[model samples]
Target: MKAEYENPFRPPYEFLASGGMVASGLAILALLEENPLPMEIRIGAAAALFLTALVRGRQGWKVFQKKRRLTRGKRFLKEETEIELDDVREIARKNPKKLWIGKGFEWSSTHRQLMKEVQDNMDETKLVGPLPKGEQSKYRETKGAVWVHGLEEEKNEKDIFIPLPDLFGHLLIVGTTRAGKSVFLSLAIAQAIERGECVIVIDPKGDPDLRAAVERACIAAGRADQFVWFHPAFPEKSARLDPLCTFNRVTELASRIASLIPSSRSGGDSFVAFSQRALNAVVNGLLQVGTKPSLIEIRRALESPAMLEELTWKALDAYCVSALESYPSLRDGAYQANAKSKGGKRSKCDIVIGLYRQHVQPSKPNTDLEGLISQKEHPHEHFGKMIAVLLPILDMLTSGPLAQLLSPEYFTDVEREMINIGQIIAQNKVLYLGLDCLSDAMVGSCIGAMFLSDLATMSGQRYNYGTIDDPVNLYIDEGAEVGKHIPFIQLLNKSGGAKFRITIAVQTIADFAAALGNKDMATQVLGNENSWIALRLRDGETQKYLADNLPETTVQYVMNTQGSSSKAGSTEFDANLGERLMQEPAELYPSAMFGKMPTCEFVGNICGQVVKGRIPFIKREEIKQAA
Candidate 1:
């Protein structure tokens, strides 16, 4: 391959050629001056030599330089040049004519010296623009503001702030276990509180420092009364969360609970469907007859076949009783049906009919207390299996403090109703649910899933029904620990308009896949969110997922070939620039670098832009002092 010559430095031959041309012209002029030749001859000769030397010298100089440069590779090239700039300070009023330039400094530098020329020609006030506005300054952060983590471009050390409304209302935060996820969480929580959006932090790990930071933000925003530590672990210090009581729609409640009940390969999909169906049946039964709806009641219904049959009959009976009273003609229809069934003997079914007619109230029946009794004919063969499948799940929900969490009335805190999550949204308050996952992992996860589902319901309803006006942010820490119970598909896709800004932090994609039961579904959940911040991911899937979000760019590659020896004299080395796209994760930032990013630094793929940034470091001491 032939060597290619680009821009090159001047060599001795190029300078000598340029000098020779001038020397020859000068020599011709000198000879003409010393000669006694005819004027025309001397002038013509000098002019011809001058023209030839001028043209040939210019061409020869370029050839010599290009040849020299081709022989030597670019080993010593200055990439940039820096120079000093001086500022002149003049006392305009006192002495206009006698101005003194200030001492020189190295702040200014330019590729072309145009800025230096401008500095000398124009009057300037200060070197840098007024120091970036303080992030915490009252003028910068206002009610309903969202603080974007890093700068729009890599220019300075300043926190960027955009209004909360500017975002699409969702975020996915992915990072390894100890990759400063908590730090970013703390920062977001702090700023979110300052922004005055109703903040609800569902932390499975029960972080105390996070609680303190939230308190500081509440204090900073002068909404301390709005700050509530919603610690279900210590129900005595917090409000009761009756999963059954807060909702108006019981079917939705059942669906939420069903969503939390994780499915397993042991049962297959049929078992999952059976549990959900039976749970829906049990919840509907409990809600219909008003038998103090709670997880304990559901547990009782699941444990006893007799109780389950009775509840089912009772719920159906209440509806029958109501229909009969509302239209007394139903009594005649019931009598006709009873007569048709009484041909054989006074069976349990007949006994049920007899009791209903005998105890029927004319104008009024206690809808809450009275219901039909289960007969021998009832209790379908599938009912027992459904109950069996649902028992352990109900047990999980009813175990430990979780059982106490879902009731509006509590043993310790009686005077004030444990404000439910819906109220938390409507009233615009900050709630921190510090689930003690470290101590009771299963119970904590179950409760977290339940609360997040309820919150997602409220968010979805916010737009469809126009109930909640204030923006709500759901900051879920250790989201993967919640398992497959969280209604991720619903939250990721539909919770935004209701102003439920979801920001979920997980350690890895594997954890999410574990929760989702499939990698594709896990990715779908992540895909719904508009913004993502991934820091130091060890899992290849997580790294690949994030790297995939980056746009493809054309990159130049060098192709080196050696020894093209057709003959002994034909041995050669060649280099060429080839361009192709960078496609794979390995071709991008190494997984190792991302797997071990420094604290506060993260690879942020947000709002259609990708950047590797740092979350301004905040110390625990600072939060403590501020608090």
Candidate 2:
């Protein structure tokens, strides 16, 4: 469409003006001639002048209309607009199959050029001073309207919507502080809740308004009972979530915890590897004794040799009893003989070790169980040093209410309900995980990372088996804090096939790089997301990152050259007037424009198309009514 449309500024105005002046001068000279011409000739010449003037006036009017259009377009673009609750309900009903992103339209190359034009031509001085009382009140009504003062638009302003299927590819929202990341999240989450999809929000900072918005969304959707809130600070009101509750293998649980240890660069891989092995050993022993593994239990087993001894003894006794039923009578006899004392005296561990060495080790051995007993037999002093880095992390997670929160004793603590990703998806529930990072970043990050690992495991399960009926919409606010975790990357990679729609919000790309300690790791995280919503980005690197993703465009500018020369007496004067069109390769949207965007306003690449949209402050009045 842009290619076919002629430039509105490109009309022959200069030529028409010159011709109009020349014709009027000729008519005057004819009228003032000393030898008057015939009346018919004069009248014909007068008609010719009139025709020239009319043509020139028509062209001038076109230029005027075009200028007005440019002004109207800018005003439309900057108008204070929002999506009310009634509008939301209407859109949901009309487009029952599509995803309503926000209220805006496709921002094409024409719009980009027009915005540049507006920026170059607008009067900056007029923008200063106090606004009209009514206008100021309107601006105060919503944060989005305040920043649209200088924004521009061309045409086709309407609601921004996308296909429901595009969500499988995932979405990434990037913005600076106080730049409406939470506002956009609230709207998106509300839509998902309204759609009856399973929504899981992982908010590290734990914005209270955002939590209220989700609660309101659930209430509006008539699914208030589905809302499950988990916050470490409010254990009495919060739900219990065991990150280690469900895993295909014990090693997965170990790897999930081990990932939190400092990388191999700071601490050698040997230390991390040993820590994982130690976790695996403890987890296996607990499973062998029919006990569910939890953070507190893992810490106790690692910190005390007595607990390890008890686990080993109980596991060995259970294995021996099982062996009597499964194996031959002779094997049972061997197990009984190994339980007897040696020459002087034998300890309980010694008897367990003897039975394992004689009966279990020779025939059929539980390699998982063997790892536990081997760690038990290892020199205590050396083993402690090997797992030194792993203990403190466990302690931080197990301390205070976190111990029961992360590791819920379902049978004993009946007040709090337990939540797992599998159940959250199957039952179509809304789970909001508030890590409360402001209070404790380390603990919050660890919990978030482990929850991501558990989510990754659940995605794997969905991928291998079959998908559930409803799609899972997962929103991770302040993603950079936990986004560096390996499981997060894995979740992004595997979530598509598992019917998961993931949206990650970050302050800036640099934050992710800083958290991951590598730029390439940050790139890896961003690469998995197919769509991006960029709000006011102040970081230079973040701006460049966004601009780099969009394809370059040709921007045309007019270059005018004027020259006049005067020669000696017999003075000859000549003037040459010429104009040229110069084209330069440029980003569709300048990197700096992102810095100037208003709150709740965004320029996004949804799927493949670009969009400039505004997210309204969705009302929660419906929450009160629904309640």
Candidate 3:
């Protein structure tokens, strides 16, 4: 074997060459001391030796230069470029074509350059403007351009920076697992908080990352007392409401469901309406006997002549009895038991976190029609009161004999009442519901839909004057898998333009689209998001979607590349060079797509101008240790 091959870790051949020169210089000096030469010749030889030594001494320096360039390039490419918030002109979703071509290419050249293009075309003047004066000083100026970060590679320099809007109506995020969706949501939340705005986080999966972030935020604001945990199964001990309140809430919900029947033209709608009306009358009539009616009193009222006269009243009596029989403890207010506390006046919680355990069958039966119906039943099996709330009264009404007479026209008032109740909850409180450990997908959807609808209703009423200007944030993590609620998305889309801002975290576009049942709507939601941060994505469709939607230069630089040819007709060639070409230059590309674990960064209008950066992500261990 060759000597160089024998010692694999030895210095390169260049080092050996330099060593030889040093040896030669020493030999020359040794010979000169022994043998006198002509003065002129000796002088010339001495000068040549000196020059050779100088060259040999600095031979290793060339390697350092190469390393320096690589380091500088990496830093320049990865460092987040600051785009002041003020100069932000507009923050709209980039068209597929626009994102594909416009992001990396320079107006004056065809060469695919990264950082140079960003530096050259970036609206430097807008990026570096005077800070706002007075109370406005508390708010940071909006970053005019969007920065793209990739999941796999160092941040690219050729990343696209589109002009951002001063104010975005709303933002929608969609992605699958580890797609950097949560990071994206955190970014938005952090920004919103920095602006001194309020935020309400609704996390169905009980993502610890999101929970920890919110906790830190509360602590930072000196408002830790505002955090509230609302577990339906475990009610607050301090809650002043009596058993009557529980019956009233249920009755009110039933009445609202009954009213919704008119909006439905199907058998299901009529059935639900009749059932809801009956349940409401039964529950309310029984409760009217005293402050809190007993199960016996409820049964007596159901059998009374006054109840039999109304079709809805009959249905209510049957459902109530059936529910009590199924869960006997409910008769004693077990379902509505309050939480245990030490007894000082509890803090007026600004955020209410709800933890509901959903009972969902992981695998559905393989039967045909029966199986389909059984699948729908899985959502209903959850323990939360929300399911009971959404269950149509029509089901109960149609079960016995009144099914034939039930009509949509009879339930209008019920539906309106439901909407009104939702509005009340949303308007009355700044609720931050964190639904932890959701096992079933449907339960998540139900929770998301119900709350989103409530928020939408309240937002529309201007019932509460809150927005990005004086905003409230709704944070959701792993939203697609945990919940597939179209109405919630629609609500978010609507609210983005209103006073509220919603942040959703998901793993992939496909998962979100599948859950939403509409690809276009999913695209609209994701695109409209003021900020989008992408993490490592392995799915082809997701990668394609990102490539198609990102700036053109970025797509070309990050996604398109030619295969390398073997050098000197040999099969082996340098793979690193090919990687370098394909690798997103962090300075040029702010976002990346390919890596073992990649992360993409984005910002838009919904985040508001003030929240450029201030999101926190503390680990559970860190929080515990700190506490």
Candidate 4:
């Protein structure tokens, strides 16, 4: 007997079968006209047709489900096991591969539970914390500040978050050039300003990116009046004579160089002790002569044969006195004393000092020295509230004595004095010093390392009295170039307890890794970062780094397929004609394919929730026009 005929109308197949039924209905209509069928028979036939169609439709649906299962089963299963951000208790980027691509994340069960807990408890007020007590009587603030947006995409983007409550510590950001580092920094600055926090930016290059952002943020936060600019104008002479003024200009240079010398180079403590004694002797000798001499004058006096022959107490005294006489304040020992006094009090201006050797150098040595003294005497006049020192790394390295004096061990007393001055300036106010023009890889690293070490020491000494509740964020652009400084890396990666947050930016992983000195350390720094804003990084190594460091399952989802496919098949059956031979097996498959898309993931409470997006790069003109 022939196999029981199955209902042909089924989903996918149903559409085809329905067309055949319509033709059959037309045939029935024709037959009815020729020989009208009984109403009962017609009803029975109609009912049977309906039942067959229903069965066919059900079967088609089953087939469709089976086809979908072939492709979606694994994905659906994986998604079931995937964890959400809110559920994450602990998050870390795991690197199974040496390269950054194909990195994945390992999460604990606690992560999910904690995230759920956080979500359940989330309240706008709680997230932002209560406004300062006094502000309550002012007005009922209902809305939360939204500074950034649009980071929910699956692709990496350049965006970062710095939460206020979690910001009472230090931070270090490291990335290669073109790595969307600057954009990340901008986010932090914007966030701090929105929260009514004070920020001082020092842009030595005079690029004004940070400065402009700070200004904008201030305006947005209704604190525009608080923004201050402190750029000192150097006389033409100083700009020309930049090399010679090194001896008479800034005192902090010496101190920084001295500090860097591995004590061994300078004969350890003994060398420092000797240097101090020599400086004292020089000072005493000048005092005895009743005349003040400038550094140049003193050097000239020392060169005389008569002074050198005897090297007597009387001769030394005369030389010292002559040098002291040039500066009236020093003649009476008041200059040093006054400096000490000024260093003690809090500075009134929000200072942003710009130190650029090329700009300060003068044509004439005498004129330059005079300008230096004048600037020093009236720092407030030139640098109002903020001082942004734009030091020219190239000029300082190539033309000035600073190149030699930068050596820690060989630093002259004058150089040491400059460093001390820098320390004093850092101590007295809320300061952000940006070292610009640090193009040299080695110098960039050295300066980065030295600045942090010195800053930490000074801050530590006055920690109690000068604890800046307002966190200070350090924005280091081109971090990979400056990554040569191991100390800088160490400080940034580890110095979180202090109210210093380091934000470094670079273009690529290779640059960053090279600057870090060791692959392990580079990994540590990148891994420790609480938040990562991945921009378009097409390099295989970078991609691999992300793959190895981000969640594997998440990466797979990001890499799913999208778009269509087709297939054909044939089936054979035996028919009654000539022992029944029939063959018909045709199939067509059309489906969409999906692969990975760019994705970004935020990991730690330290960074909190991140907001990532492209912000309009507003120039000063644009801002003014908007105003």
**Highest-lDDT candidate:** 2
TM-score of each: 0.63, 0.84, 0.47, 0.41
lDDT (Cα atoms) of all candidates against the true structure: 0.58, 0.78, 0.39, 0.37
Task: State each candidate's clash count.
Answer: 4, 0, 79, 119
Candidate 1 lDDT over residue span 211-296, tens digit each: 77677666655678888786756766775666555455656766666665556552356756666656666776676776666778
Residue 189 accuracy (lDDT) in model 2: 83
List where candidate 1 sits over 4 angstroms from the true fold.
1-163, 246-248, 264-268, 290-292, 305-321, 325-382, 410-417, 556-592, 621-627
Ranking by lDDT: 2, 1, 3, 4
Model 2 vs. true fold: TM: 0.84
Candidate 3: lDDT of 426? 37
lDDT of 2 at 461: 78
Q: Put down candidate 2 lDDT per residue, 208-280, tens digits, no spaces.
A: 9999988877877788899999999898899998898768777899999999997846335899989999999
Whole-structure CA lDDT of model 1: 0.58
Candidate 4, residue 88: how far the Cα is off, in Å: 28
Model 2 misplacement above 4 A:
1-80, 125-155, 265-268, 325-344, 564-575, 622-627
| Candidate 4 positional error at 447, Å | 5.6
lDDT score at residue 608, model 4, on the 0-100 scale: 33
- Candidate 1: residue 323 lDDT (0-100): 52
